[model samples]
Target: MSAETPGPRRSNYSSMPVAYAAIGASSAPDLLRFPPAESTPYEETLQLGSGTERFLTAANLLMTWGAQRVAGVEVVDIDPGEPSEYPGVHFTETGTPELGAAREELFTPEGEAYLLAGTTASFVVGSKDPRRILVVTTVNESNRLGFAWGDRDEVAGYGEQQLTVEIREDSTVWAVARGFTFQSSTGITAGLKQRAHVKEAVAQAQAFLQALAPGAALRNGVAKPADEPDENDQSADDQPSA
Candidate 1:
């Protein structure tokens, strides 16, 4: 499934509900299950605060694209030139969460579930080049909130990422991030670049967890970098004065 544009690089968003390379994989809670055999896979999980309030807070933040913002990743919507031609809901370049607009335009029912299916945007991670992606799957159930995206027109490789927050029977909340990537580009530097790719992917997931609870220990037990800032720390402006 592909869409034609004026440029050389085409978009994969035209397929809507199944735009990504590995479709329907992120829809399930366990991403480890039917893995993309060719791509390298990684999973990261963190125990967020327990209870309903914590779960709701994290869900709302994720639904609003707060995780990307916290990861220092810039998300810009690609203008399809003709808005009407584009399918499903899409965000503005400002990356603002317009759930009301999505509900009204996309005919999404008014309820707690918030799945922005078929959203397309460009993500700029660090100083590296931008990677275009489409939202292929989203889970917005009573006890879970998550979305998955796939890389589009990337020169280095193709990949899919799933970021989700779930609550257990005992009300213990958890954050899970997982993804797989397969590099296609070839060159003397390609091997080194792919290694960076995995690291970046892991770091991206870690950022999502850290954003929710800075300085919180990872369930995988990976050590945090020495210079990682504790966003949970109260700034001077955040402190109350006498």
Candidate 2:
């Protein structure tokens, strides 16, 4: 269920250095192949335990912004209303419609709110400020699920982050996060900002991996048997009377 190829130079993405340049390059062998000129790239991949369930769980967390949430960053979804005019292809459906619909129904409410191209979200990282970005590309193939985004001029640098989860032929599920960025500041300030950015990126990537590791699915939406009590669940005795 691939989306339409994005149109060139859409007005909504003028703020990015080269909008959509890194669209589908997130999982590429080489990150440099499609990044904006001169931007530095980074990537991290975690091997999730093998299974179809693991892949779906990881993908669900990703679509719901699990990485940012687990890393202690706040996510704010920016609504664009119906017939969204934001940049990039807007479809989130992947693989065949049946499979895509199944995943969507499982992860999102009403099967209509999964992340898609043109969707926008802001990551509020501490008191500094929120970084808003627009999705530029998405992959919803049978074995792979991922999405990439471009900076929306809300941050100090222009860049993007791509997140994906895939199941190999052997049924091994892997989670990956990769992106490119260049500080907009100059001289000494730029150096400091770049280092900080790299640190934050790596931290968030690790959080993403941790969110999908073994035993993570329970908290992430995988159902636990009704007879078993979740450690995090509050017992009736612990609740105050309303």
Candidate 3:
């Protein structure tokens, strides 16, 4: 193992200036929401591709709770066992015309072949110090998919989030996450807050396409930074919006 590692804590800044790290490095623009406060709503969007079944199919992988076990994250509880486990890990079909009215192709209700509108699951983010659980509130494929338990469990605040990926009439495929979380988590430390959970979602969005179609270059969505630099349209930092 190397003597140095990447994590939330470090002493490198002890001998240096600027509060444990370079201001530019630690103060990267958070494309989530700014003026971070309690009960705030955050959204991050990404342009994936043209509207088509192919893109929706890629998104379906996320709704099916399959991506939770991907490269950087892993499912912690995503299986149906007993009723005592009221919040049993399971996927239920949210019948959309895309899957047929009866959703037969989705498999028997008790079958493990698919996920519907109400499907939900849980997962952890980091390998060394998995901090919080990402919870799902809804998983309606191709129509309306969302989450209702992340910001609450994470930010000492509470809110739900939904990711909508759809092709517009112009054939542009867009994926966006809309959610609410408390402005400040009571117990979480400073470095952790700076991680920007919204950014993680954005990365996950990109990963969806990467997994479905490797080498695909998903475009980043632009957000208006909370603060613009004096006399300059850009923020105090030169970083572009993610």
Candidate 4:
């Protein structure tokens, strides 16, 4: 007899309850897998501290949070204008209305991590300027932050020139300080004094963050709804109508 060829095999599988049960049994654990835990509000609050401490900590925290969150970091030493370089750092001419100075640079990985982890903004008193100055800058995001100054001779009169720092989208930060005679308003002294005020404001903001949330990431000082959902993927039925 000639050898017989085997025909195509047919699967006897059907919607058998036992087989279905077995299939479900094998897959059930997958459905039970837990989702990743989210960062707690308390933890987030702790990440963002206040004052020089907070500023430093927030800068450091940003490294892990994301690049966009960090932006940049600046530390202004408002003394009789000393040579501006941080050792392993670079600077470039920003611009000015008159005879002033401004610059910016990138942070190294160590610097980025350190700032993101936590660092304190430092201030030093300068002899030529005779004013304590604070340096302010971003932490980890990018090089798009700047500083500026303005001043007036009369204490009661408005400011003449406004010192301004601007970070363009292209990752350039600049600063300018100037003095002029203008109508009454808030006047700032173009040089060291204006720098000092900027420092003070930064310090105050830092302290506020620390006191508000010791270790939480500092939120950008932008307005947001109090009861907004944490994630956007939720369906319309999942969210309350505005």
- Per-residue lDDT of candidate 4, residues 117-189 (tens digit): 1112222233322222222222122321222121212232112111222234443333222222122233464
Q: lDDT per model, in order? A: 0.57, 0.59, 0.36, 0.24
Per residue, candidate 1 scores C-alpha lDDT tens digits across 1-242 of: 11210121234666432223444343333345435444556789898877665665566556556577566677787432222433333223343222212222111112332336566778887898887886655665578777777776654546777888888999888888877666555689877777888787788788887665533323324343222334453332211111
Rank candidates, lDDT, best first: 2, 1, 3, 4
The TM-score of predicted model 2 comes to 0.67
lDDT of 3: 0.36
lDDT of 3 at 172: 67
Candidate 3 residue-wise lDDT, 135-230, digit = tens: 333344444333323321333332344545555677766666554433333355733653464455445555543433312322222221122123
Instruction: For each of the candidates, give the backbone clash count.
Output: 0, 1, 7, 45
State, as a TM-score between 0 and 1, how close model 1 is to the true structure: 0.63
lDDT for model 2, please: 0.59
Model 3: residues >4 Å from true position, as ranges? Answer: 1-37, 80-112, 116-120, 128-136, 139-159, 184-242
Residue range with the least summed lDDT across 10 consecutive positions in model 3? 18-27
